[model samples]
Target chain A: MKENYDIVIIGGGPAGLAAAVSAYDNGAKNILILEREPRLGGILNQCIHNGFGLTRFKESLSGPEYAYRFIKEVEARDIDVLLNTTVLSLEDNKTITAINSEYGVFSITPKAVILSMGCRERSRGALNIPGSRPAGIYSAGTAQKYVNIKGYLPGKRVVILGSGDIGLIMARRMTLEGAKVLAVCEIMPYSSGLRRNIEQCLNDFNIPLYLNHTITKIEGTSRVTGVVVSKVDENKQPIEGTEMHFDCDTVLFSVGLIPENELTKGAGIEQSRNTRGAVVYQNRETMIDGIFACGNVLQVHDLVDFVSEESEIAGACAANYVLNGRQEHNPISCINGDNISYVLPQKIDKNIPGNVKLFFRVRNTFKHCKIVVESNGVVLQEKKKLICVPGEMETVILSSDVIAKAEGDIVVRLEC
Target chain B: MNKQLTCIECPMGCLIEVEVENGAVKSVKGNTCLRGKMYAENEVICPLRVVTSTVKTVSGKMVSVKTDKPVRKSEIFEVMKKINSLTLDRNVVIGDVILANIDRDANLVATQNYND
Candidate 1:
């Protein structure tokens, strides 16, 4: 195996796998995927639920299923996949220093790098719930890994806070494993999970979903004793005299997901505060010509299918960059105006072929909505959707014909 | 029967009410689809369900597995008993038969991602 390759992908999850395969298909022969875990699949291994692969497969499949499709593609393509390896540091010169027993602290200087480190689950400490820092408090992702992937129940009685997908899935998973879920408390009036998840994971399980409520404090010592939950006002401040205690052994927090951008940030990439991700080109390339990002590391995707879908673009871009050098000019900026969380591909080169696709998410869920892409108040294209949720991503197509006409900055906005 | 049921045929989530007379559906209402009306009729007599959850595995993921045929509303526990007795050996693929002949006809199958 060569130390230096055309591409160096940071994570070997679905994103890296798809990217590697796509890179191979798109002309880059020497591509490498470095993952920290012993296995390639990242969070998908623990997801274990359906609702993934709807877009990519056109049929519903579980998380692992969706991941295996990409994994199989990479395997079939004979892509280099390195497990139990972590990229220690990345430099401005596209040099990656990675360590593994097989390749101990090797320096690989690739022409380009794709960052797909994925996101990390926010823990209890980040929530600042005033209480004793004790055991039996785990992030929903940790507990999920324990039960779904590791085959060990986290607890017999659990109270999960935050209704993100992992928390909702865990609520049902814990129930089926013979544990009594006290309740799922959400600080907001609505769950952050997909509406389908709320219906399938909680409503079907007969679990009580307390909206506009939260766990004010955790009461535990060595292990876990109980928890103090309370109702809150619109500002999420606990209502006085509304604190209630539930005798549960575990408290799981699924607060939110933070994209792991240490390397991207360290590399001096321009990121968006709204998306908490890097502002990239249509090719998923950051302002740094040779660098790219995809998957949860780019933005927390509701389904793994979209991750696989996006990785292809990143991989193809990296491969194209390695093969014929990236085109540098004719960049058209992408803007996210009101109601839109953020837009990927912050810019696009007019020289590119075909229509460009921009993926984004909304701040709130809407039953019926329109996503409009415009240039200087001139609506370029508009898409109407019957149902749109914040958990699910929305994409708009900007045709090459449209790009040919883009005289000014392209702005993407969502309307209810 | 003194219970109300919702049709899960689709995302419509049709709320349907049913009344049973002489162990059979006597009246059904609030169903938006023909399938929902039929579901209301059958639910009063022999309620069918689509059970989804993870099953124990020897060395694979604790991924979702669905019964080829939904268990009888009253036989969910019995079906689970049978499902518990069986084990998924290593190298089980998706759609692999983990517990065949579940109810003389149905098969308990792996629905999650796996490789044989």
Candidate 2:
């Protein structure tokens, strides 16, 4: 095996696969992808439902299909892929300590590194729902894997908590598999899933969606027997008398996803408190000279297309860092203001002479609002949006000239 | 008759109202694009969706598959039954036809390779 490479992309999911392909296409030949999973497709292998790749492929494809396209592209270019390789530690100096069954513990120092380790679903422990720790309670993603990949039904009666895409999709999936989906309870006033999913998954199947509600208690001893649902007030505190019990056998939690950044944390990379991922510049390069990050590792993205797009930038930037030496540039911090929760590429390198797309999510739902970007007390750009939700990600592009001329922090705010 | 539907043509998901007369779409309103109008009309006439599910392989591993074309919405459960009952006895790659002529104008095709 090669001891050194121009670029090493961690996590062979859609993000890493796309990054490797993009890096190879842009003159980085000696690139390798390290995937912890036995398969190269990552979580896409378990996502059997369609409605992916509409932006990148122009056709609705299943998750596996979308991932296979990139896998095929990587294979065609003869890009090196190491599967079942778990990366243990990532050093600040671009050294990756990895281990595999075939090859024992080994250290590889690439010229540059791209972190694409995607996010994981929030588990029951995080929710802290009052309950007897028992069987039949699974994360929506874990249940998805059991049903879609392992061909096993988790339970006959299911109660899904959270109206996110996976929970909604599983509501339909469990129904198709002959399970009675009692209800989908969301803690928020608005669903954290796409409207299309709500329409197609829950609405089409006649499953009731309870908004501004949460599970008050789990009533079961050996397994999940039922759950008590209750409405929450403005402060997210459960209304005492609103508790309603529903008898169910299974409980699926679809709360949220957290970016897997243990390696980044280990490397002592600067992280965003909002995104829970690495803080990076417009080029997706972290504060560290040769290290970069993209995809869900930087911030959890709604669509794989956006992940591919972001990783492409990271891949290109890493390749440039290896081929051409690192360039010194004046950088400005990007600040999230008002209703805006967080913005990606938290910093903009003024030296990069191109438009930088700032992707962000609102803290709450709003209708008919304008996204305003300001820098140096000057309004650089503003765009109107009819509706905005935390579930759906939004993007605005800023010209390099605007970033370069900025003397203060770049601020993105929503004016309703 | 008046029918309300959401246009799934794109992410906009316009709320479309369709007026149906004599089993035909008379008009579609509140749709922002022609695709939405067409979608409303088709949804009023006959809703269709691509069915995705997994079939057991010879090695006992489940392989994900989907219809090559849209299946009539009314027959989704029926098609799903057919899909659930099916079991492939050989290795298959993506795009391999698992079942031919599944429902109206549809073929069950593998979305991922099952080497095992």
Candidate 3:
């Protein structure tokens, strides 16, 4: 391994692979991708379901197939990659400390670094469901890895806890594999998963989706035997006298995903309270110069197609930072307005050229609403939508002319 | 016959109402796009879906595979049975056909490269 390089991307998932390829294509020849997995594809290896790459490729592809497109691109570009290598630390000075079986403790000082470590599913402990430490309990993603990668079924009868995409997909998967799916309970009234998944994965299989319900208590010892499902009130507190019982062996938790930002935090980078990831600019560069983040590490994207698009921006910007040096940044804060959960590229550099795409999600479901972007009481952009749900992310573009005329912090909100 | 279906063509998940008369789709409503209209029509007449799953290699490793095209939804389990029973010992790359004519003209192809 080289002691110095132009760009070092952490994680070889779809994000990292696409970043590396984009960096190489944009003039940075010396680039390296460090993947902790034995292979290049990260989470995509275990995501065997189709419905990926719809926007980018304009064709529905499986996770591995979507990843293969970028992997093939990386191979064709002859980009360097180190599999089974875990990055130990990332310093503010753009230095990376990594370790692998081939090489012991080593360090590399790259001119620019791109973080694409992705996100992890919120496990049972995170959910704090009153349950026994049973053997049949597994996170939805873990169950996916078990069934899709290891070729082992987690259990025969399953009761998924949350209606996240992974849980919804597993509902169908376990059923197809000859397991009996009892129920999918979600505490929230609306599922965080896409509507398409709710239609295809759960509705198609005739799986019961109990909204406003949660597993109140888990009854099991060495293995899962059953769970008590309870209905929740508007405040999400379990109500009395509304208990349902299900006899199932496995309980899969698919609550939510948290961005893996250990290294980002270690680097002392500013973090976003909403995304739980690094606070980046329009170009995806973090507070620290030359250190950038994209993909799930930046924001948990609903589609891999957006992950690829965002990582490409990070990759290209990192290359520019390496070749042309740092450009002037006139900071413009983007405030989350009413009903807006969070907006990405938390801050934008006004000096950057071209239009800017601001991605965000609503706090709740709204019908026949208008998304408006405002700065200093002047409307920059506004668009009408038939419906807006927290499950689906929304984006609005701001032209350079409107950005140039901005006088104060920009705000994005719903104008119902 | 009147049927209600959700358009899976995109994330919008348009709740479509289809009017079928004598086993033919007469009308589709509530779809936001052309694709949703087509999807509703096809779903009413004959539904199709791309099946993706993992097949075991000789080395006991799992290699992901998918149908090259959408197959009849009714024959998904039959296609999966064919996929589950097949075992390959040869090296294969993405787009390589693992099983041909598994569902009509839809070939089961490898989604991930496996070398053993």
Candidate 4:
């Protein structure tokens, strides 16, 4: 109904909602959230699981609950919400072209923009699973969405090919509703999901989890009926003699998640193959002026609360941009070093908030290591932790005071 | 004291700053509408959450289920008490309402993909 204004947020997930809310709180009043789904809620609609909202709200809430909290916040604010609206592209300094079934197509030039389109699942095609093209094969996330949100059962007896979080969760999910989960097979020796999930969701249920294994063959005609699982060696090569076959109607693949960056890429933002995402500043701002990204669109996080936190930062910054028009703050280079997989803030600014949370992931599992944050190779700050696992994301907070003193680039590295 | 409130209604997360003056909400600030205000007030007091997770089944599968409606956030662990006590009957379909009464009020619905 309205023409153009302050902020235009893409995707109606938790990140988009948080960005819109935080932007308004910081004084960017004119805001709009465009969601492609029939309604808001995004992936949380299908998540239907707990372990959410622990950080944002002291209570453990489900995905829907976490999303609803922000949804409720967005409704309270005067931010315009446009659901069932798909953003076609972004061009020419945050100019947006989007369409909804009800409203044809429209273009808007927002002063500031936030992108929270989330991510996508690695389908069976992405995984060279070396099997027949079958009807029963389904991505664990897709199966989850249909089963949990859309209220459709995907299979009867299932063999999950990957031990990712969604697959692991689905293993337990299918079992609860009276389906027999034969086994959860993982290619890598180590599981990609959180350890607690393995112990509680799979082990407690008396389900077998086969590590260092891969699904060799899928057997079925018009429907799925059987699958062959083979053991893998140290290098993850499938061993010949270790092949085991099972009779099952469904095969769920829980391989991996990929950031949805078609819009980001089309925007011509600088991207890194390592992260598969556009390089952004400390404030979650993309390389382009007045454009920002957060949540899975920026980085994949194990917990939605971190997504909420990052989106809040993105939201506040977008609001600041609307109110103050292009912040003139000193920048500090951010780098990943040592065992550190990657540092979130590719760069930093002088006027960061009092509690600035820097998110990152580790290269591999490590125990009792020191995470040192350095400036110009000098140890500025370091924290020792008992455990750091690649499955779980790590966050370090440096007070605004410490950030103000930084002159050159900042580096995060892991040391013994 | 009226705590500034925002609706946690849907994923929209309507931000409303509510003013609570004497242990009671005085006025809500920054919400789009009344739905958001009521949502924020409810969030301040009895925030409800749904529980969807895996439960052990005799068939060696993990069945996912959720409380039919949202339950009090404080009652999540308690509600799981009922879920822990539950065992699926043979041939249960997806989207079947597993337990309609959780702690006497919460409704638990079975997920669609239960090994099928």
Please tell me which predicted candidate would have the highest lDDT against the true structure. 3
Which of candidates 1 and 4 reaches a greater DockQ? 1
* C-alpha DockQ for predicted model 1: 0.29
The predictions' CA RMSDs to the true structure, in order, are 3.9, 1.3, 1.3, 12.3
Better of 1 and 2 by TM-score: 2
Q: Candidate 3 falls in which docking quality class?
A: medium
Residue-level error in angstroms, candidate 1, position B64:
7.0
Query: Clashing residue pairs in candidate 2, if any?
Result: none
DockQ of each: 0.29, 0.71, 0.76, 0.07
Interface RMSD of 4: 10.7
**Per lDDT, what order, best first?**
3, 2, 1, 4
For model 2, residues A1-416, the per-residue Cα lDDT tens digits are 68778899999998898888888888899988999988898888889999889888888889999999999999999578889899999999889999999899999999999999999999988878897987999999999999998899999999999999899999999998999999999989998988778888888789999999999899889998999999999999999999988999999999999999999999999999999999999889998888989899899998888899999999888889888979996888899999999998899888888999999999998899999999877998999999898988999988867776678889999999
Interface RMSD of each: 3.8, 1.3, 1.1, 10.7
| Alpha-carbon DockQ of candidate 2 | 0.71
**Prediction 3 TM-score vs. true:** 0.98
Lowest summed lDDT across 10 adjacent residues in model 3 chain A is found at A123-132
Candidate 1 off by > 4 Å: A366-369, A385-388, B1-84, B87-91, B110-116
Lowest summed lDDT across 10 adjacent residues in model 4 chain A is found at A195-204
Docking class of 1: acceptable
Clashing pairs in 1: none
